[model samples]
Target: MTDDARELADDVQELAEAQRQHWQNTYTTHPGMYGEKPSSPAVHAALVFRAAGAKDVLELGAGHGRDSLYFAREGFTAQATDFRPVGLKQLRRAAQEQGVAARLSTVVHDVRDPLSLPDASVDAAFAHMLLCMALSTKDVQALAAEVRRVLRPGGTLVYTVRHTGDAHYGAGTAHGDDIYEHGGFAVHFFPRHLVDSLADGWTLNQVHAFEEGDLPRRLWGVTQSLPQ
Candidate 1:
């Protein structure tokens, strides 16, 4: 590659690192940004998983254990993973207080990297808002592939992302490929086509739209499954 190209790539990498730190600080500073209630999408996904007879579940980007604890309370064994140690520490404590410690476990994991689990080990995988976290298109693809790998045949993978219709979609400083920075954080907005591209290998089951927050954050709740 040319020197200019290499330098640009290096700068991008540095930016990504800074983005990671920003997210870390987000959880550290606002420990209850999401509160303890399981998100609506999570509740909906849990119903679907339960109906499908899913018992062993993996939850990625499980902030403060809301959805994970809910899964455990509903009698599913849940393994929750997050990149932030601060959040995981809170998760462990909450599980203990709820007396669901045996049914739930927490691990530090970066969704941008390969998931640290055996292949086909989980009956379902869920991530509420992990897809839009400053991740490039490539990062989302890698995360999808890893989720597919760790899921058992016929296992469901449910996730949510900020859709292009979101109010903040084009309002923030552009980072690239629909990603933007705002208020010390980065977000990657997903157009419907990009969502389809990421679901290439899996059977797309549903893509439902919902809105959250007072600004009404528009999001897509998507569910996909590996061909059994």
Candidate 2:
């Protein structure tokens, strides 16, 4: 690789490791920080999945299993994955306490890597504010492809991402590729075109704008489905 390309790769690697460590520390310091209640997106996703006759749900970036646990309680077998083990540990504890351990499972996974799931194994997938993390445009595209690969034909995917219109879109240190670091957390604010491009091979269902959290992070709730 050229010197510039090598530097960019190194920067990406460093940022990813730093974010992982930050998440670990954050989760350890504030266990169940996001509370036990599922996000609104998850609630909406459950309804969509149920309407589509989905039985199994794969959740990416399932911090502390709030949504995954909710899914299990709602009668869908849920598999939750996150890059941080601390969060998953809390998730497992909560799952057992909630009596959903039998229907819930956890995996420590980073979205930058290929998902370790069999092809067409899941009926639905959900991700809230995950695709907006410190990922490059290419990484997000690859992750979307992986999600598509692991979902059954006609399977549904419901994901949410903070878009460029958010208040913190250009705040803090820029990491290029629309990624910016704010208070140690990196985010890749999505542009409209990128979202449209990712749905190229899929049936674009809906893109609804919404806000969450105290900051009221502006996001788009996107739903797509593979061809049957």
Clashes of 2: 0
Per-residue lDDT of 130 in model 2: 92
- Taken over the whole model, the C-alpha lDDT of each candidate is 0.85, 0.94
Error of 1 at 83 (Å): 0.8
TM-score of each: 0.93, 0.97
Task: State the lDDT of candidate 2 residue by residue for 1-228, as single tens digits.
Answer: 999777766787789889999989999999999998899999999999999999999999999889999999999999999999999999999888889999999999999999999999999999999999888887899999999999999999999999999999999998878889998999999999999999999999999999888897999999999999
lDDT for each residue of candidate 1 in 1-228, tens digit (9 for 90 to 100): 999656645654666789767767887889867888888988998898997789998999897879998899889999999888888898899899989999998889888779889999999999987888777777788888888889998999999999888888888687667877777767788999988987787899999998989988899999988788
Off by over 4 Å in 2: 1-5
RMSD for each model, in Å, please?
Answer: 1.8, 1.1
Q: lDDT score of model 2? A: 0.94
Lowest lDDT 10-residue stretch of candidate 2? 4-13
Clashing residue pairs in candidate 2 (N, C-alpha, C atoms within 3 angstroms): none
